[model samples]
Target: MNISRRQMLILLPAAAVAWKSVLAGTPESSPNYKMSEHWWSMLIDISKCIGCGNCVRACQTENDVPDGYFRTWVERYHVSDENMTNPEVISPDGGKEGFPEAKEDGGKYFYVPKLCNQCADSPCTQVCPVGATFVTPDGAVLVDQTYCLGCAYCVQACPYGCRYIHPQKKVVDKCTLCYHRITKGLTTACCEACPTGARQLADLKNPNDPIHAFLKTHSVQVLKPQMATGAKVFYNDLDGSVR
Candidate 1:
């Protein structure tokens, strides 16, 4: 059956649109997800983190993050009894590989995973001249790489040092909480890869979500609460020495 010229024209444009969607990284929409019905967040239990670098490796692989850059990472802290306020912190290769044996024995050692806080009043969004950075209604901060100017204003404005200029793409990049996955009713790669269940994806709007119960019973804290960014990542058993 041969198609007429008018029919071919219409089919060509429709096929182009379909191909564009296939090339796009994130889906236009998920069939079952309602953005308004969910407020996404993450919960990190410091006590449960073994600093094995599973989260880091998983994030890099899932997101195709460039080498020497991280969408999510881990830092190991050593707080000596002598000086509690000034802890030694280090993240070798974004903690993609597990840390070496600790030389110092007397200090308290703990691991702290870090990512984009997905702030409610994000300074990064405020600084983006082109409005490339914005927060979704469901509480995830994302960058529209197509519109990003690569001015690095958002990178400087971020207090948590989460954003980075993509070396190849020439656009600002950061953690999206695995937007593609979360919007599809799946957990973030970091949360899924955590062996000890140290990381948990949360839906604040869900009545049955464990985050509500956990928040009530646990003494949780957000990083740099004084900044008051309304960060969604909640840390349980966080140390005072953590910056």
Candidate 2:
């Protein structure tokens, strides 16, 4: 059938409106879209951490981390000498809540929280034979348990020894950056649970966010720079001697 010029004109406007409506309804059109660039990271201030283990408990409750496995943990480092030749790195009982009071000792003590670095060139993604491990558009590293073959390639590929195979589920699991929470317009459990506000969750893509400003104002460094993973997590006022 042949359409008249007038009929074609009428259909064109309707089609344009429909297309515009669809685009406008998408998340990309929302103000939050600009903040979703797949490069989410975190900055931890060593001085602000109180070793309270609030973040640890919050992660377990929020993500249901297995009893034996932890999505995140804190490490205690002690450096006695200015030469920095000898240092002690110890993690006592995974920093679970109700930890015993610090023993009487003569050394400097500080806690460093550790989690998935969520690298841009993530080794987990490269080692996943089934493509189960992938980086999200917003820079969050995730594992698709559905597609996982129970292989521990990712577990081994990680340099920081962060990833682990869940004992009960028999699947690899690690920190997800609270994907559900962030998508729902909420901060990460660890960030929310932090009493000192040392841990923060912000969109790196949003220049208006404090994180963006912090990155610009202060010098930050990722863990294991030689690995060249382009890690998303940054540490402010980090001691270069500590790995």
Q: Give the number of the best model, judged by lDDT.
A: 1
Candidate 1 positional error at 129, Å: 0.9
lDDT string for model 1 (202-226, tens) is: 9999999999999999999999999
lDDT of model number 2: 0.81
Candidate 2 deviant stretches above 4 angstroms: 1-38, 98-106
How many Å off is the CA of 79 in candidate 2? 0.9
Task: Report lDDT (Cα) of residue 58, candidate 1.
Answer: 99
Q: Where does candidate 1 have its weakest 10-residue lDDT segment?
A: 23-32
Give the CA lDDT, 0 to 100, for residue 148 in model 2.
90
Model 2 RMSD, rounded to 1 decimal: 9.1
lDDT of 2 by residue, 127-168 (tens): 888899998988899999988988899999998888899888
Using all chains and alpha carbons, the TM-scores for the candidates as numbered come to 0.87, 0.81
